[model samples]
Structure formats: structure tokens, C-alpha cells
Target: MKTDTRPILSALPEILKDRCGAFICCASYEERSRCISGAVKDLPFERVVIFAIADIFSGIEDRALEIKSNFSNKTNSEIVLTKTHEPLFTANVVAKSLRRIMDDGINDIFIDITTFTHELLLILLRQINRFKDRLAKVTCLYTSARSYSIGDPDDRKWLSKGCKEIRSVVGFPGLLVPGRPTCLIVLVGFEHERATRTIVEMDPELLLIGKGIPSVEHLTDESHKAPMEFFHNLVQTMVSSRGSVEPFEFSCREPYQTARTILELVTKKPDFNHIIAPLNTKISTVAVALAAMANQKIQVCYAEPETYNFNGYSEPGDKVSIFDLDWDREL
Candidate 1:
């Protein structure tokens, strides 16, 4: 059966119309094509400029050319495909190329680079800002297929710290750095305990299993029975006490299924306030593009992690203690 991807494509029109620029980055050629197809279906292709990288370029060129050749092509959107043999290694060069493209009177651009790393994204982001006058709005997309858990102590510390640092530097509002390891964040109100419980219970345990750790042999079976039971119980407890919760999961790899799943949930529950995502390079560029296209109040949070500090120029003092946590009367 074909995958039901309507949820992801639903809010795209609003996002495209509201923003002056859009960028989509994916991990693979196939995903790039799929994302492009879905994105173009709703966006105003007449003013759009798509920049495809490497193997993805080859696949999209055929479609782009065919579209250009067709008489019914009512839009003036242009698709430029380029090859990058060593993408991550040459991010600075790629950023310069992108800057040149943006300078060519094209305000809206979509970039697809799922093969690169978070550091490369940082480089690109830095460069994009260099030509901010030419670019009114910029959107970065990221994609990954796995799901991560926030339960890991080490992972939480890294993400929380990273988010704080990025916010201190960038100052973009609505900065949501979810604590979950998976990139998907679920916003459930205090009242939807039953539904939340059921959804969590149905989640696959294998989805939560991380790398290096031994895979649970019975994950599939156990997940089928009640994969997110522990999660649901925890949520139920939190809700019963009148506390609200926002839970997210970050996957380690590309083409994150968790993102797709969360998009589906949002479609069914449009009443939810908003979805906040961290503007980290680790996320798939395609996913970022997809999120940008959504109609909800989009907020970008920037964080420059202390781990990236060099020359002893780290942010002075401990920023972690600033968070609203009670250490004196601890549990």
C-alpha cells in the first residue's frame, strides 16, 4: 500500500506563501525527489529556486527538465542541480556557491543536503547570514529515519546544554529544544491522557532502541503488545497531577520516521498551540523545510554549543543554572 503522506503535505501552502525563501535538505536521492515532488505540489513554483546536490541532482534534473519543457509550466521556478563529491568536507565552498545563487535576484531557495553533517550546516547557516540583505527569509530542512529517547542522561545533558548555548547566541524566539532523542516532539495537553497513553503504548520499542546498545531481541513483539507503555504511564502520572508535557524524540540517522509520525498527529489535532523545533544542524534539511511550510507559528532557536568552543572563548560562567530548576529542595 502507498504511504499516506497527506499529513506532511497539508500545511505546505501556508508556509510557502508566508516565507520569502525555502530550503530542503535530505539524506538520499530518493528522499530528495519525494520531498521535492511533495513540496512543489503546493508551493508557487514560478518564483521558487531549487538547488539539488550530488546524486540527488542527477535524479531531479530529468524531472526538472521535463517540467521546464512542458507547455503547461505556468511557473517561472528554476531548478539548478550541482554535484558535490565531498559535501561535508567542502561546505565553505558550497556555501559560497549558494550565496552566489541567492545574489542572482532569487529570494526563495530550497537546498537539499541530507548527506552532510551538523557542522556543515553551521557553516552554511553562517554563510547564508553573510548575504542576509539579499535573502529576506531562509529555511533549512533536515531528514532522518530513526527515533531517539530523551531518557538517556548523557543525551539530555548534551541537547539541553546545546540548546541553551544556541539561544544565547542567536536569540531567535520560540526556540524549542526538545529533550527527546528523536526529532519528533509530541505536544499533548493535560486532558488527553487516554489518547496519549494509547499512542505511546502502540509505539515500537525498536524505535526507541539506540545504537551501540544491544538490540532487544523481543522488541518487535514487545512493542506490538505495548511499546510505549512506560511512556504512557509516565504521561498519565504527569497529567493526573495537572502538569502539561511536551515530549520529543530525536533519531540518530536520516529520513526520520518520527517526524512523519508527529506530522500525522498534528493534522488530527490542529487545536494544539504550536510545534517548536531546535534549529540544529543534526536535523535533516528536508524535515526543516517541511516544518517551515506548516501553518503553525514557526519559531527558530539557534544554539552554539560549548563543545564547539575554541581558543578559550567559551561563554563566561555556567548557563545551565539559569534554567528554572530547584536544586536546593531537590527530589
Candidate 2:
């Protein structure tokens, strides 16, 4: 049998030769390493940037140093270590830093959010939006490495909502790509099929609507209605709450189309208070961008199976489950 490694190898050179930069934000050294390794193996870019959240780096400095040494021979890579203990790397700071990096002419940026808070990821996405036009291709990789406590179900749900908001914004042009498995796909309750018809008729927003677990999976088909229904229901829910809602549709299979849809949405709707997203590694970056675009306070709640407090806080010792929510609502 003939083997086909050509596609993989071909993509590598393009990714490597392309102007690429990456950011890895997490609370654990092991998580950071995994992100770094995954990035290196996937992209063939000549330049790579790795940023680590401070809390996870404190105890793993020695290990980090070792990892850095291992890659010392690679001339096109650089690592940025930030201390989460300090207030310096705030969302605005992260945004500015990313702008600087992109201004320096590095395209194809990647961010890994395996161990960071949903808030931090939002900050990064906001920064990416600042330079969407100037930057090349930006990709975010979300890995489910951290476990949330059982006591914070509300928190998890909030986080999931925040992630959806980020997707709304990042899915815009010159922003990050969506439909990747890492992107979050929040399933609002299934409603009547008329929900999809309403979305088609209104055509209020530029959205990538489809059916399937991952947006990417339904990208190839142009007739999927789940996304449209989701959007329609979301609009109805928002309007019912006295909030204005807009919709935009795009081809999730094509990066440019996805980006264009996002850009259009941003241009058309400037009064939306918040963008709700799911809490998954794949879609956190999108949440980040929405928070920035709205310039409003971003809030998240996780939806893990862990028990939550009456006030929606999670205890430290609870066992986190899947179904975590990633969302951002306007404050």
C-alpha cells in the first residue's frame, strides 16, 4: 500500500514558511509543554512566539528552562514568560503585545488555552481584533486539560457563554478561524424548524450556521440549518430580554468566508452589549474577541457537572465534568 504523507509535509512547509507566531497561556507547565509541542509539530513557520501564564510557570521554571534549551537550536522561535501574579499582563496589555508582534510582520499566530482562565483568553482575542487587518492568519488551539470543581456549575456555564461571544467576534475577517473542533459549539435547546426559516428571512447578521457537533464538520454543506436556528433562537431570546440581536451567516468551511462574515457582523451591529459563547478550548479565542469588540465587562460561567454554589461559584476540591459552559455576557 502506498502511504500519503505528502499533504502533511506540504502543509508543514507552508505553515513554517509562512510568517507565524503563537501564544500558549496556561496555569500548568505540563499543559504549556503540550501546547508548545503541538504547535511545533503542526506549523512550519519560521518564527514562533510562546507566552506562558505566570502561576503555572513558578514551580516549573526549571522544566521550562530545560524545554527552552531543547529548542535552542531552532532559530525562528521565541518564548515569552509572564507572571500571572502581576497585573502587568492585563487584557489590554496582552492585546497591545499581540499588536506589537503582528505589527512586526508576523502572520499566522496561534494561541493555546489549556490552563488559563476564560477571562485571560478573552483578553488575548480582543488584542487580536485590534490588528485583524494587519495580521496574517491567526489560529487558537483549546485543549481540555484542566478539571473544574463540581461546585461551580454556574461558573462553567458562564465560561461556555463567554466562549460563544468570542467566536462571534473572532469569526470575523482577519480574525481567528472557527469551525475547528477546538472551537466551542453551544447547543441551545432544539427549537421548531421555523427558527431556521426565521433566520433565513431576517438575514440580520452574518453567521456561519450549520448542523453537526463541530462547525467545521458542517462547513462543506451550504444547506445546514442548525446554526441558523441557533442564531434565530438566540436573537429571540436576546430581544425578549430587551436586548437587540443581529445575525450573519457564512461558509464555515472556508476561512476567508468565515472571516468576512465576522467582519460584517462587527460593522453592522455596534450596540450589542455582549456576545455569548460556549466554554471549550476551541472557541475561547472567539469569546476573547467579542469581549474586546463590545468594550464591555466580560463575565463567564462554567457548565461542568460539578456542584455549584448558590451564587454560582466553584469550590477548589470538586471534580469537574464535561459539558462545561464557556460564555461571555455583557456587564
Candidate 3:
């Protein structure tokens, strides 16, 4: 990780100028289409591809039209609708779309995984690794909310309806061999209730990784403390504690390193069941996704929030961390 943080205005010129990018997002009842469209409108891309779930196309019709309208006058934009439930199928569709763009002679690419599910991220990362040599540079983008709402009690729907609670990440084909040490590697984030559910449900050897005490500048001190403490308490609540929770510095953050660490620590043990829940930074989520791609026995799970604080979760903060990965070198 480098100190590449900048405001969206400062960052967009460099990232989106003359670059062919794809925005893989989920459309819901909320303002998700607006969120996706709003960001892409600012970018000066040669071509932009929007990948969304079929349900999103049908369910969020008006916003979808608006998104298309937003980009119609600017760049040559296209929307690819896919079956969001099937990870492998979705990956195949996205891969073909990206390859078609490459066939059109656009090499340098950026992927906005901000609205993607953990499974979607995993498969897409795997697809990117496959086509690494066809591109000059690859950059992954994510939008982090300033504050996440636990949600109002009256809300009954999820913001990301396209996501799956649990899925078998591709590259992991079969069940784990018997008598293996099953481990659950969790990247701790804000949700205590979700984290607790994961701990209770999986019951694997717990391996926790989270941000350091004094986290990054963007996160409020109170907001940061809550998640860290929640992780600690969740671990303590476990009757058979696996071990200690680990912390990583914001500046030294390495998604690939984090993924590689998980492989070195658990997968290499042989005959293991790796269940990863990435509730941390998008970069860290990428790390976990990479790890899931490395082996066939691993499973990735996500517990989507019932409701989002759409109003409170402000965006495009002072800093934007750009996580770069050279697939050939890293993988």
C-alpha cells in the first residue's frame, strides 16, 4: 500500500482518464443506482461497462434508465445484466465482457467493486488473474462510507439484495478431506451482531485480523473503537478460543500479503476447511478473495445488513486508498 490517498476530484482525473473501466454493482430499492451512476459520471473514461444483476435491471428500472441516461451523452457505455446468484456463471459473463473490451483494443482497466458482493469480488478477482497478461495496468476501486448505520428498526429490506449469505468460492471445487483442521479466517469490521452470528455458525478455528488501535485518518475515533472492541468481546465470548486477534497498519496494508498469510498459516496445513468472512476494507476483502481462489476447499460467507443508513453513510471523503495488484507478480 502507498500513500496514494486523494479526494475523488483529485483521484478521478488520473484513474478514469482514457481508461476503460467496468463498474460491477448491485441495484436495489435504495439509491444504489444513483451511487454507481454518480461516481461514474465524474470519470472521463473512453468506455464504461456497467455490470448488474438481472433482478437489479428489472427491480430498479427507473434508476437503471437514469444510469444509462447519465452516461449516454458522454462515453460509449454498455450494461451487462447477469445472474447474480450463481458465482461461476457471473464470473464467466463478466470475464467475457472484459475480454470483449480487450478485444476492442482497450488494455488498461479499472474495476469498481464498491457495490459487489464478497463472492462477486472473489470470482472477478480470479477472472482478472486469468487475463493479467492482456492488460498493462489494473486498479481496483472501492467507496467507503464515512459512517455505517446499524439501521432503523422499521426497515425490512437489504441494501444489497444481490448478495448471497454463503457461497462456495470458485477455485475451491470439492468438500474438505476428512480429519482436517478447519479454520475460519475473519477480517473483523463494524458489525458485532453479524460477527457473533458467524462465530456461532461456523465454529472453526478462529483467526481474526483487523485494523490497528489508532486506525486510519478517515475513520472517526469513536467509530474505530467500536469495531475493535466488538472484535475483542466476540473472541472472549467464544468458549474455545482459537488464539489472539492480529492487527495491521493502514500504511503497511497488503491485501495480497494478508491473503498469502492466511494460505501460509492455514491452507498449507493440508486437508483444511477455510471459511473467510471479509467485513473489513475492500482491499482486505480482495486479499481474502485471492486466498479463496488459491484453493478449492475454501468457502466465503457474508452476512448482509438488514438495512443501511443511506442518509448517514456519507462518501468521497478526504482520502482514497488505491490498492494496486500485479497479478503475475503477486499470484
Q: So what's the TM-score on candidate 1?
A: 0.34
| Candidate 1: regions farther than 4 A off | 1-7, 20-28, 45-47, 55-76, 79-81, 86-97, 104-123, 142-331
Per residue, candidate 3 scores C-alpha lDDT tens digits across 1-331 of 3424434534555545565454444443334335535665766555666666664235554555566667643446777666655666777787887787777676666665556655566667777778778777777665544444334221221122222254456644435667776666666654545555666666665454444334444332234455455554554465335563433332123566667676675544465566777766566677776666665466777664444434433333333455666665544
Per-prediction count of colliding residue pairs? 33, 66, 1
Q: What is the lDDT of residue 252 in candidate 3?
A: 20
The model with the greatest TM-score is 3
Off by over 4 Å in 2: 1-27, 35-44, 72-76, 83-88, 92-96, 144-288, 291-331
Q: Residue 65 in model 3: shift from native, Å?
A: 3.2
Best by lDDT: 3
User: By summed lDDT, which 10 consecutive residues of candidate 3 come out lowest?
Assistant: 154-163
Encode model 2's per-residue lDDT on 1-331: one tens digit a residue: 0011112212332434443454334434343344334434544444445555555335545544444444433565555555433433455456556665666677556554444444455555556665767655555443322322223332122211211112122222223223311112221222222223333333333332222233533222222234334444554554343222333333323222333344454445443322333222324224334433543322222221211122332212111111111222221
| Span of ten consecutive residues with least summed lDDT in model 1 | 318-327
The superposed Cα distance between candidate 1 and the true structure at residue 115, in angstroms, equals 6.7
The 0-to-1 C-alpha lDDT of every candidate, in the order given, reads: 0.34, 0.37, 0.56
Per-residue CA lDDT of model 1 for 85-126, tens digit only, reads 343444545565665566557665544343333334434554
Question: What TM-score does candidate 2 reach?
Answer: 0.43
Q: Which of the two candidates, 1 or 2, achieves a greater lDDT against the reference?
A: 2
lDDT of 2 at 301: 21
